[model samples]
Target: MVNMSTSQSNTSLSNGTAALYPAAVTQRSGGETWFEVGRSKTYTPTADDIGHVLKFECAPSPSPRRLISVSGIDVPGHLDLDGRISSGGTFTVLSYNILSDAYASSELYSYCPSWALSWTYRRQNLLREIVGYRADIVCLQEVQSDHFEEFFAPELDKHGYQALFKRKTAEDNVALIVVLEAKFGNHGIDNPGKRQLVCVLRSSDGNIWFTSVFNSAPHALLAMGKVDPLHPDLAIDPLGILRPAAKLTHQLPLVSAYSSFARVGVGLGLEQRRKMDPATNEPLFTNCTRDFIGTHDYIFYSADSLTVESLLELLDEDSLRKDTALPSPEWSSDHIALLAEFRCKPRTRR
Candidate 1:
């Protein structure tokens, strides 16, 4: 565990408005947690007024403890943690690809028939829930244009979040990236390709780059020659396409494979059914598991930062583990959201 201690001098404002600063406490377990001392108010803060002070305390276990103090009033607020210090001198940053939108046909099936309606009514509520997590920066995937134009745009504005989206493609697809004004000043947008959107966030602590990506191809499934004797075309390679956008995110590129259980073989008959192998009754339903070592595979790469280690880790774990269990189809959209966290050091000046 790590810990930090911070201090600031009080200052006055010229507009006759004095700011009330809050001391913040941050912790990390499965996800990051943050606590603040005061509420939000409109006021101009002076150089002397300490808007926020953070203390980090590092403790490995229950016994002995050691503490470290990070100085500089211009530091970014997100890096301030009560314990566990990073040399980069920035706040904790988190990014996730939220698969919130469902297909129209799936919606009609009543699994989540009211998804769009409920999302419309509670869009602000959803944004509030995300903000409550206290993540300094966020990158959202699968944000439909209609959803943003009608709901998320105005709702996020209320919270002082500035958003920049990629230009709409011929497919009408776009990804949204948002940054809080309090911590970082907006630099601009970086368009790597049609499917990837990038932005640079500048703060006193450091300049952080964020990217959002969505792959265009569907996942394919492999079939053995004996299993599909009728049609050779019925068999798919199973190894899906990898997106370049994954490279920009500075983490392993994830390929979301949509599983299918539909059969493409000969139709079942009363007499022939008896001869069929019981195990072959539902070939499409069989779970898939694969392992790769020292080779570049279709779904992932061999690069240290770009390898899909987390996804492979999930597949390696036992299904009984609650954390590794696949989410029920009724609740989730077509694919599961994959996430990874990376720590970056502040760039030095010559």
Candidate 2:
């Protein structure tokens, strides 16, 4: 059944006035002829409408007769990396920061249409895309506290997902963690400004750990020993005001799943290079806005315990900027979601 919502576009007509047209009437290339299947906003597809494009159209006014069309279930742009892991103990993890309504301002996302930016519109869009991925675990940031209690928690529960929510004190942004299967342990770590959720799952080999972090600082680099504090380009104190006497580093063998996975030619490895930053090898950009575009979200795993089997191909910048920035009709959030499929590596016997 297709549920048509007029929240994205303002309409003067009554509910039953909108039309649902099966792909048979609409031209797949571009032109949409007005052959109406039903006048009601809800439509159920028949076997005959199998291969055609379905579109819904509504006219706001009778005088000028302006028609606005909403496309129906177009093919997603990402490379389909299905069935890559043929065997034992594989799971997928997704990390995303669904832009909070508080921050989804027209001034900030001026390129985005008002109807697309509305919480009513974007919330449904985000949920549809998120559920479609079918990840074993989902970590979402910038989820408002109210939304966690009212909307996301109840809705996801229907899909057999259990969740953990942590909100920053006095901040509208909250961190959400969800797992489809049983988990060994889960925890939330509160940093200076942002929150991180870590999920630990038990495998026959060892404990497989995954984390969703929204960090703008270079702390991840420090922990991995990838950046030198003394380098000319690398500042001893990036924030400047909080310089320390000694450089900070960690002993954890944490690694970015995207960087650790090597590129290949088939279904799973399809467009790996195009998705990554040429220099950093990370995603080209996770957070894209009108003024700022960069990677602020990451999914890290214990490299020694897990091996990446597949990754969801990142959408290119050109596609993202087609509507000037994110929060566009196609994408619900300013940040794009990142997903990786991992398998636990067998432990060596002593």
Candidate 3:
């Protein structure tokens, strides 16, 4: 029998050569496995390599079958093995708002007392449905700290995920945001009142960063509006407040900006009707659409091959349909979720 000890040290077992020894006589323990390399010096086994068969011998049991042969055993060391693919391609990400009952804290809203309990049950069910989507990265808005810890966090852990963000309360309104990472590291941004979480993923393929922002009441625009619009302190447009920092850090912006835009639009429509003559009201109202606020959710995505300008151009072209009617409450949330994707340049070989 060829000594296995010498083979391990050589690291150059000959091609088309099979080494065999008594299974019991092998030095490898039950949990240990063997690695084989071909004779070609140009080729070496790496985590990305795959397609090798592993055979095993089993002793005869007290049954009719003698000297049982293991039917199927495959080597599992390679990163590309077992149907695993390289992570160089573009992947989809989804951001969603888990509608926690607005009545939970008994705020100014006039919802039934039982609405909170019913909403919690529905939220759990909705979370389960969201988990089924199998997204690479998930950003959640409106998650309560205690609810996230006691319920959502545990559920997410079962599917290989991590949560970020601490609970904060202002008045009776609570805003929570969390990101679930699938094979990546989590990072955070220090926005004192507007707590945001950023995650960085560095794989052999490329680097991907995701940032989640959950704006509190009097959101980003309003916050910026509080400052003098013409003040030298604000050279950039109010909407551009977050842009500079994001561009400097090279982080993708995925914002879930929810506001009472729907209510605002209704109010605007009423004001327009009052200004029109009684007989011309119908035609004027039909033609006068409220442009006070647009859709809420916005996703900004990019890669090394893409620039901010190009990304914005694409967003303008494909982000929304001007002709499509807005979905009803049952079919949609008060806000929409924006999605963006871009191909990254391949990494250079060393």
User: Which candidate should be chosen as best, given TM-score against the real structure?
Assistant: 2
Which residue pairs does candidate 3 place in steric collision?
A: 47-79
Give the per-residue Cα lDDT of candidate 1 at 208: 18
> Distance (Å) between predicted and true CA of 264, model 1?
41
lDDT of each: 0.28, 0.55, 0.32
Best prediction by lDDT: 2
- Tens digit per residue, CA lDDT, model 3, 1-350: 12222223333334446433223222233544344323232443433333333433221111111111111112221123345433433343555554444523323222222332345334544554456555556766666677687667877888887866545333222222333222331111112122223222110111111111223112332223232333333343344433343233223343221111111223333333333334311111111111222323343332223211111001111222232211111212223332222223233323
Per-residue lDDT for 1-350 in model 2, tens only?
23222222222323354433332221112232334356566777765455445567432210111111111212222112352322234567887778889888988888988888887667767877777788888877778898887778887897888977866553222223232332322211111222222332111111111122223234334335443445333343334532342344555466666664334434434455556775675777777888888766666665555556666666678876778888787787888777877654432323
Model 1, residue 295: C-alpha shift (Å): 19
What is candidate 2's CA lDDT for residue 276?
71
Q: Decide which is better by TM-score, 2 or 3.
A: 2
Candidate 1 vs candidate 3, lDDT winner: 3
The number of residue pairs in model 2 that clash at the backbone is 1
Q: What lDDT is reached at residue 66 by model 1? A: 15
lDDT of 3 at 101: 49
Winner on lDDT (1 vs 2): 2
